[model samples]
Target: MRISRLAPEVATSRLIARTSGLLTVMGGLGAIALVLGSAGAMHPGAAALGPVTAGVGLVVMRWGHRIPLSGYRFLMAAGVVDIGVFAYASPTVGAAVAMLSLSAFAAMGSFLFFALPCALGYLAELLVMGAVVVVARGDVDAGVAGVLAVLVVGCAGAMAVVAHRAATAHEDALTGLVNRRGFDEALEAAVRATARTGEPLSAALFDLDHFKAVNDSRGHAAGDEMLRAVAATWTPLLPGTAVLARHGGDEFALLLPGSDGGSALACAEALRAALPHIGTSVGVAELAPGDSPADLMRRADAALYRVKSRGRGRSELDAGGQSPMARDLAAALAAGTSGGLSVHLQPVVTPADGEIVGVEALVRWTHPELGAVPPADFVPVAEREGLIGALGAFVWLAACRDARTLSEATGRSLFLTVNVSGLELDDPGFPDRVLATLAGSGWPAERTVVEVTESLVEAESTRSVHALHVLREHGLRVAIDDFGTGYSALSRLDTLPTDFLKLDNSFVSAITTSTRRARLLRSVMALADALDLILIAEGVETPEQARALASLGCPLAQGYLYGRPRPVAELVASLTAADVVDPPAVALASG
Candidate 1:
C-alpha cells in the first residue's frame, strides 16, 4: 500500500515555554526579595523597597520569556523574598517584627519551587530581624511575629498545591509527559509564535506495535511499565527545544519548535532505534504557516498509519502532511466503498481430535485506492471515529448469512462466532438489530456466538450491559474474548453471562517454557472447566504451542498453526481440504 506521511501539530514547545516563563518569573522574584530583605536594605523603607522590589519582579517576569526554566526559578525566589520584605515594612515596631517573621514563613513555603535557597532565605531573614530588634532597642513582639509567620506559611502552602495541580493536569500521569490536551494548547501558541517569528516548527506522533496483544497477554500493569520504558528511552534523546507528551494509551506526540521536517525525521529515527524489543511507527509533519491543529493531527495520524502499513520500526516524514491511505479510505467510503470491507474466516479446531467445531470471522479492507490496507492500520481509526459499529454490523450480517448457508448443507450443526466490538453494547438498537437480522435471514440465533473482550466490557456503559443481557436472553451465545488481559477480568467473569473464555496468547507463550506459566495456564483451564465454560486458546502459532495447550486439556485452539485467516471462500476451501465435512446450511441472524 502507498502510505501517506503524518504532520502532527507544533504545540507542545509553546506550552513548555509558557510554563517555564511563569515559573521563572515567580521563582526569581521570591529569591531576590529574600536576599535584599535579609541584607536589611529592603527592610523598614516601605517607600523605596516597595517600588524597587516590584520593579525587580517585573524584570524577572519579562526575562523569563527568554530563558524560561532559569527565569522561572529566579522569579519564584524573588516573589518569596518580596513577600517577606512586604511583611517587615509594616508601620509599628511590633508589626515590622511580625512582618519579618511572616517573610520567613513565606520563604519556607517557596521551597516547593526552590528548596535550598528558600530554606536559607527563611533562616537568614529571621536572624536579620532579631538583630535589628536587638540593635535598635525597639519593642519586639516575638509572639505576633511567630503568629504572622505561621499564617504566611499556611497561605503559601495552599498556593503550592494549586500550582502543583495545574502542572499535573497538563502532564500525562503515566509518563510525566505533556498530555494530548496540553499538547493542543501548546500547539496553538506555537502556531501563533511561528507566524510572528517566521520560524518552522514540527510535530510527530509515535505508536507502539502490537501493543494491544502485549497488554492482553501480559497484564495492563506490564503494559504500563512498557509504556514508561518507551517514554524513558525517548525523552532524553529529544533536543532541549522539543516538547513531547504521551498523547494517550500507546500513542505519543512530540512538538519541536524551530525545527523543519528533516530535523524532526532525524529525531524520530533516533527514538525509533532506542527501544529494545518493541518497534515504533513515527509520523511527523512540520507546520505550514496557517494549518489548524486538527489538520496537522490528521496528517500525523495518516502518516503513522502509512508507516504501520509498511510494517513498524520506521520513521516517515510528512512534508506535505497528507495521509494518502486515510484520504483514500475516506474517498472510497464516500464513493460507496461498501464492497471494500468483507469478512475472512479462520478455522478453530477441537485440540482433542482436530475436528472443526467453528470458525472465527475477521474483517479485511482492500481499499480501491490504498490497496490492501491492513486491519490493524484502519481498525483503530474506525473504532476511534465510532465507525466500528457500522463495520461490526456489516461483518456480523455477512458471517451469519454464510453460516446459515453452510449449516443446512452438512446436517451437522456448525457454530459461527463473530467478533463483537465494544461499541455494539451501547448501540441502542444492537440486540434488536441482531435478532431482526437473524429473523430476516431465517438463521437460528443459537448457532451464532458473539465474542467480546474484557477491554470492550470496560468500554461498555450500564445500558450496554443491559443490552448484552438482552442478547443472552434471546439465546445467543456470549464469550469473553481475550480473557485474562484486562484489569477487570475476575470481576467480569463473576458477573457477565459468558459461555467461553478465550485465553490470550501471552499465557500460551509461557506454557512451553516456564513452569509458573504452565501452572497458571492449568489453573485457568481448571477454572474454565469448573465453570463449565468452553476454553479456546488464541495465538497457537506453532505446532508445539498447540500441542502444549492440548496437553493442558484446552479443548479448542486457533492460530496460524492450523490455518491463517483468509477470505470466506478461501477459508471454506481450506476446511474442506482438511477433510472437515461442511454442515448443512442453517438459518441464523442476517448479521
Candidate 2:
C-alpha cells in the first residue's frame, strides 16, 4: 500500500503486523533473561512488563489484518522504540553487542518487506542505535562494534541477494520489466483490490507492430536493444500504481489500478508517443462489473487483435457494450457455459453407406428473454464486442466434453468437429487452447477436427495458417469448411494442411439439377482424392441429392438430409445401436 515503484515487493500489512508481534514477544523474553541474570538488580516493574508485552504480541498477531496498511508503519515505529530501549539500558558493551541480534531481525523484516530505500533507512537506524550504545559503555569494545557492523551489513547483503533473485525471477532480463508470472500476480491483486475499493482497474496489452520484421532484418540483438530502449523510455514515465510487464516476445502488458478505460487510453497515448522508433498496437479494457482477471485480459487482448486486423500502430479500448444484445450475450457466456449457451450436434455422414461418421459442433444460444438467438445474429456481435474468444473457448470445452458423452451414450466412436472464427484462428494460442480442451475433457486428439471457414483459409493470414498447422501437428485434423464458396487458388490446396473439405451448401443444393454443378462436384471428389482429403457434402436435403453424392463417390456429407442440429443428448438418444438415426434425413441419405 506504499504506492512505491516496488509496490509488488512490499510486505503486506498483516505480515508486518505479525512480525511486530513476534518481535515484541522476543523483546519481552529477552527482558526476562536480563532480570534473571541481574541478581535482583532489575526492578519488579520490568518483570511485570514481560508478561504484558507477550500478551500484546498475541493480540497483535491475532488481529493483524485490522491494522492500517497491514501495519508497516506500526512495525517500523515499534522497531525504533525497541532498539532505543535496548540501546539506552544496556549495562555493558557485551550486552550492547548481544542486543544487535534483535537489530538483525528488524533489518531483515524491513529489507524484505519495504522497498530498497525504506529498507536501507531502517537498517541505518539499527546500526546508529547500536553504535551509540557501544560508545556509551565507556569501554573500548571495538570487537562489539565490529560485530554490530557485521550484523547490520550482513543482513543488508543477504537481503540484497534475496531481492535480486526475487526481481530476476519475476523481471524480464531484456527489458527489465515485469515478466509474465509477475504480471499475472499483479493483475490478480489489482482485480481483487479494485473490487474492494470500487475503484477502476484497467488492463492493456501492447505489441510492437513490426517487431518480427525488425528481428528478421536487424538481427535479434537489435530487437533486444529496441525492446530495452522502449522499456527504459517508458519506465520512468509510468505512475507508481501502473505496472508494466513483458507479456511475451514483442508483447507487453500493463495494469493501471484506479484508472478507468478513458484514463487508461490517455496513458496509452502517452506511452505511444514515448516510443520514438517503432509503432505499437495496444488494447485497453477496464474491469467490468463481475469481471475476473482473465476476463479483463481477454477483452483487452481481443481489442488488440481487432486493432491489428483493422490496421496496426494504434490503440483500441474494449469500450464495453458495442450493443445491448452484445453485452447481454457476453454476460450470458460468462455467467455459465450451460446457462443460456450450448453446443448442438449435427451429423457428418458417410454418403456411400449413409452411416454417421462424425458430428459438427454448432454453438447455439437460447436467450432467457429473446428465445433462440440465431448464430448469424449473435456471432457477429461476439466478433464486434470482443467476446468471440470467450465464446469460442466455451464451445470447445463444452463440445469436447459433450462429444465424449455422445460417444459413451451411443456406444459409438465419433470424431468431433468444432467451427472456429477467423479472429479465433488468428490467435497463435488458439490451437493450444483447443488441445487443452480435448485433454482436459478426456477426448482423444486424433478424433478431433477443427473447422475453419474456407473464406478464412483463402485469406491466408500467416498466424491463422500457423495455428492450423500446429493443430494438425498435434494429431488434430483441419477441415476447410464450406469449400467451393471461398476464392482459394486450387494450387494452394497442395501446400495448405488439410484433412477434409465440406462442399458449400450452395454447391450441394444445385448439384441435383445442374449438370455443371454435378460435374464440378465430381472434379472436387477427384481433387479430394489427389490431396488425400475427405469430402463431406453439405446440405443434402433430398434423397436425390444424397444418391447423387453417393453416385459421385463422395465419401462423407452432412446436412438436414442426415439430421438437423440437435443437443448431444437428443442426437445420441435418436440414434440406433449401429449409429443409424431414425429420421427421414437418415433414410434419405441411405439411397
Candidate 3:
C-alpha cells in the first residue's frame, strides 16, 4: 500500500511530472479565462480567486524532474487546493462546472501513480473538498457538486482497476519476486541514485543451469517449485537496498547499491553457495562512467555468456575492461561478413560407405582482436545480445556459399544441415527468413536440413514446434539433434514431425566400453527405424566405435575418425594432399 516502498520507477516519475505540467496548464487557462470575463462585476471575491488559482498553477508547474517520487503526496494535495480555487475563480455556472469536472484528473492521477489505499485516501480528500466548495459558494449549486463527485469517483474507480493490473504486471505470480518490468524500474532508479550520490551500483543476472532438464524430467510442477524455492532462498540473503526480480523461466536479475565489482562478485558467490542443489551461472557488472542501465546489463550478459560457455555454476564479473574484444561480438559478426563470421561444414555420412552424404554448417566467429572465438563462446553472446537472428541468418548465407562451391567441386548437391536454437523458433518470421535465405542462396529446400536439439522438441513449445511443422511443409527437413541427451518423452516421438534423429555424443562416447549404453543406442536406432526416421550416430572418434556402430546397423554417423570439422579448403586438401586452408569459417568431417 505504501508507494514510498516501491522503487522510484522512472516511467512513473515521468508520468507524474508530465501530468502535473498538464494540470498546471489546465488551471492557468481557467484562471486567464475568468480574468478576461466579467467576474469582477458579478462576484467581487471571484476576481481575487483568479489570481489565487494562477498562483497554484505556477507552483504546480515548478514540480518537475527535480522533485522526487516521495513529493507526490504534496503534489496531489496542491492539485486539490488548485481545483477548489479554480471552480470559484469563475462567476458563470457553466465555467464553474467545467472547472469542477477537471478535478477528476487529480483523482485519476492518484490511482495511476499510487496504491489503492493511497488513491482512496486522496478521493476522500476530494469528496470533502467538493462538499466545502458547495457549502462555501452560494453561486455554485449542489447539482454541480454531485456531477463533480460522479466524474472523479468514476474515473478513479477505473484507474484503480488499471493500477491493480499494473501492480500484478510488475510481479511474478509463482515466485512472488518482481518480474522483468519491476527489475528494469528498480535498475533505473538505482542508476539515478548512484548518479546523484556518487555511490557504486552493481547489477547481476542469474541463469539456472540445466533447468530445462528439470522441467522435462520432473514435470512443470517441480520446475515451478524450483523457481519459487530459488526466490525464497535468495530473498532473505539480499540486503535491504537490493532488488531481485525474476527474468522469466529460470533466469533472474539483481540490483545492488553501494556495491562495486569485487563486492558484487562476493555477493554473487554467497548466493550461489546458498543454493540447495541447482547450479547457477551469474554475470555481474558495475555502473561505469556515462553508462546507462542497458549498457551495464549488456556487459553483465556478455560476462554471463562467457561463464556459461566455460561451464555453469560459477560467477563472472565484467570489470569495465572485461572482454572488450567480445563485448558486442554479434555486431562484430555482422560487420565481419568477409572475414569474422563464417560457416564451417562438418560432414554427416553413411557409416558403412564412408561417403559424405551431407555437411553440417557450424558457425565460427573470429574477432579482430580475439581471433578464432569458438562457436560455443560467440553463439551465447549472439543469443544474449539479441544478435542470434543475425547470426543464424549469416550461417545460412555462408552455408549456401559453401554448398554451392562444394557442389561444383564434387559434382552433386549434398543435403546441408545447419543448427538452430529453439529461441529462433519463437520468431514468427523465422520460416520466412529461412525461406528467404534459401531462395536468395539458390539452395533447394529439399537439400537443406535444419537441426534443432531434442530438448527443444521435448519442451513442446507450440510456437517452436509449429515452426518446425511450417519448415517441413515448406520442404525443409527437420532433424532432432543431441538425441539421448534430453528429457525425451517417448510417447511424443511418434507424433514429432522429424526426418532424422542424431544420437548424442554423451551416449556415443561410452557406447564401446559400456554395453548398457550400446544397447540404449541400439534401442534408439530401432525406435527411429520403427517411425521411418533416419538415425545418425554422432561423435565417432575411434575405429572400434565406428565398427561397433556399423555392426549394430547405424545408417549414418560422423566424428573425428572421419577427419574433424574443417574448412572447404581443408576438405579439398583432405581429398587431395595439397596444403590449403580457408581464409575463414569452414569445418567439415569425412564419412
lDDT of 1 by residue, 90-128 (tens): 445644553454454334334334334444464455455
lDDT of 1 at 221: 95
Shift of residue 503 alpha carbon in model 1, Å: 27
Alpha-carbon runs more than 4 Å astray in model 2: 3-7, 40-88, 91-94, 117-125, 128-132, 138-148, 210-223, 273-279, 309-313, 321-343, 349-355, 366-371, 382-413, 421-443, 453-474, 480-591
Best by TM-score: 2
lDDT to native, each model: 0.66, 0.78, 0.75
If scored against the real structure, what TM-score would every candidate get? 0.47, 0.74, 0.71
Q: Cα deviation of 301 in candidate 3 (Å)?
A: 4.9
lDDT of 3 at 33: 72
In model 1, which regions exceed 4 Å deviation? 1-91, 94-138, 321-591
1 or 2, which is superior by lDDT? 2
Q: What is the per-residue lDDT of model 2 for residues 248-295, given as tens digits with 9 covering 90 to 100? A: 888889999999999999999899989866898899999998888978
Q: Could you tell me which 10 consecutive residues in candidate 1 have the lowest summed lDDT? A: 1-10
RMSD of each: 14.2, 6.2, 7.0
Instruction: Indicate whether candidate 2 or candidate 3 has the larger lDDT.
Output: 2
